[model samples]
Target: MEIRWLEAFVAVAEELHFGRAAARLRLAQSPLSQTIRKLEKELGTTLFDRSTRSVALTPAGHAFLPHAHRVFEELELGRQATRATAGVVYGTVSIGFSGALNHLTLPPLTRAVRQRYPEVQLSLTGRVMTGDGVEQLEQGGLDIAFVGLPIDPSPVRTRLIGREPLGAALPIDHPLARESAIDLADLADEGFITTPAAAGSALQELATQACVKAGFRPRVVQEITDPYMILTLVSAGVGVALMSSGVAGIMPSSATFVPLRGEPTYMDHALAWLDDNPSPVLKAVLALAEEVLPTPER
Candidate 1:
């Protein structure tokens, strides 16, 4: 039977009133009735029990209803996929972003996409670290990602989009907090609060390793992943933290941010996607990012 016949059948089964179903489908009642009749004849079964006053689904119709719904759903999904592949102005692009990059990058990127590709949908997944973002991009869960660098750029193509220097976050009352700048070596005696290595905190790893290179190992008192929470721990006087400079703007009032002295240390942010990914929406998003953010010199 034709798909339209199935549509008519399902609509009628739901509404249980021919006039209402016909009105809902924007079809004349007589033609809708004819389509249902044709569908029932093709199946060699009576689908609906009709009276002068009302209509109800027969046992056969009840069993067929679910299958009809599935057919329509699958067909519609296929249509949308085909349209998206054809570069139609539709479909969704899922983006994964690290927490540190969220405040600086996500809002403007989302607004640009919505403005340029109004019909395309944007799905944002935040707080994903570089390692998880890389995994998600490979598994097709994310179309693109803004990740902290020191990532293995192999297999997935990545481009540097932004950079922020690593800085010290200290309790406001700490003696060292009075310094406009603090060297990593000077903080050796203090406990450190940082993200876990397994959480793929490239910046934290870099900071800790730098401390090690400076003739002292960090005594980490807290291992947390969320950027703001790390700052909160610092503010509570738990330990000093090495965090991105951007945190200075939103860090807790009890915490003070100081530039790291003696080296131009920085955390690089990059946009990454599977090299084999052939999404046109991804292409459009990259173009927008190029225009909005300053790309690192190759």
Candidate 2:
């Protein structure tokens, strides 16, 4: 079918609302509805189940969505290849990074890319948790991402970039805060603060797993997304938190970070990208990342 038809289909599929999809595409609602109908007829299958109340994708639509995204990705790749033939490496590489990498890794990597490829543009989105970054990479929204490790290995390729011990954040006046290193079992009865489970935080998983191995389940008192907020809550004596030792640099004055003893717990950091992505610009960036920021040895 026509490219416009696929565009209309993707917009409606993502928005799931005829009016909003039409507005997003800058088309009249009536025409947008007609376009969907035409696309459905051409494909010989219904894509969405619609009612006055809501819109939902049919099974066929679910299966077709990823392919639809691939079409646009391929088109962009072709355009980049054409530019490359003219001796110019140019394209926007969208990158997503979690807050953990904000202090050390991301800044250097970004500067290297800009300096090496002046014509290439880097689109950066920060505070993107691990789970969201993976979803964005799968959907073609991000070309590369710095994500937490111990993730599923399929669909995406990853390389270890950094590793650091996991530690505890406690109120400065807390009894355990005076110790050189604290054991997970020592804090078993203490209320804990952590990132949301739904956000797919590997750090959260690691902390929970460590506590489980220590014999008792941690009683979570609060869930937060920001590292600063988590530390702030800890400083207020809301609860203790398990965090990367790197966070010690930014630790609030009222809070203290102590290494986990008994068991050496650590958080692994990695760079991830889709294996099937054909963007030449992405390839260039990945190469630059390798040279500028070499993967740390395990």
Candidate 3:
């Protein structure tokens, strides 16, 4: 019915907790609960199953979630198109990016903006990890960011641009480097190099989870923010590192990237910005990115 109703529904569905969802929306728990009740009555179906201990999405909620997302996406597109037609496209947009994206997604997007929207200037900050990037967007310090995916959606709007399976970066002389592919369980005892947990690296999370699934926790020997430095450490035989398969092209000569066998671990790349950001320059860049940076085929 109302946009607020959809907003409450989506938030509650994502969090699966009324209190957390209310906190995320900056609304009182009572009001949020009422909104959901009103929405359910209007739709003639229950959206969530609530109990004293836990909350779960009902079948109807699961079916309606994607449609709610599409409604917001279409509304955003309409606003961007209207602004573009108004020709208010000249302004500076600040961008933040993690080290992993510097060589992958950032270059082409920046180049396209430079060529097409020369009147618009970009101020860029490098080596900002996903958590930091999301914070910057919420704080209005960054107009947009290239960040790792699966971040909290409550803070910013995001569009997924790329994804790839993670692989191991090992010293060329390492025994596993000689194999075409190795099981992740094989490296359980080996020390690993990864980005800092505080940096909010999606790769670090995914790799750790993969290792756990393979029946062992990764023994992290070092933490580095820069993906290149992580690879360099691997080359030096300091510790093995888990990296995106897409980054193999940039690997150092002393390091070899080996794909992980069995269940795959993937890293998703995305562009994020505050949904309320009204900069026409940001709108123009987003439009251009839509045209130039379509998700790569697997």
Best by TM-score: 2
Candidate 2 residue-wise lDDT, 1-298, digit = tens: 9889999999999999999999999999999999999999999999999999999999999998888988987887788899999978889999998775356778888899888889998898877778878889998789998888978666988888889888899999999898998778999889999988898888889889889989989999999887678889999999999988888888889999998887577788889999888889999899989987788887
TM-score of candidate 3 versus the correct structure, residues matched by position? 0.70
**Model 3, residue 35: what's the lDDT?**
100
Error of 2 at 263 (Å): 5.4
Q: After superposition, how far is residue 139 of candidate 2 from its true place, in Å?
A: 5.2
- Winning candidate number (lDDT): 2
Flag regions of model 1 displaced more than 4 Å. 1-88
lDDT of 3: 0.87
TM-scores for candidates 1 onward, in order: 0.70, 0.78, 0.70
Clashes of each: 0, 0, 0
Q: Write the per-residue lDDT of candidate 3 for residues 1-298, one digit (tens) a residue.
A: 8999999999999999999999999999999999999999999999999999999999999999988987876676576566578774566789998765458788899999989987677999987888888998997689998887799766598888988888899999999899999999899999999999988887788889988999999999999888889999999999998898988888889999999998777788889998788666787799899887787665
In model 2, the clashing pairs are none
lDDT score, candidate 1: 0.83
Candidate-wise lDDT, in order: 0.83, 0.88, 0.87
lDDT score of residue 66 within candidate 1:
85
Off by over 4 Å in 3: 1-88, 296-298
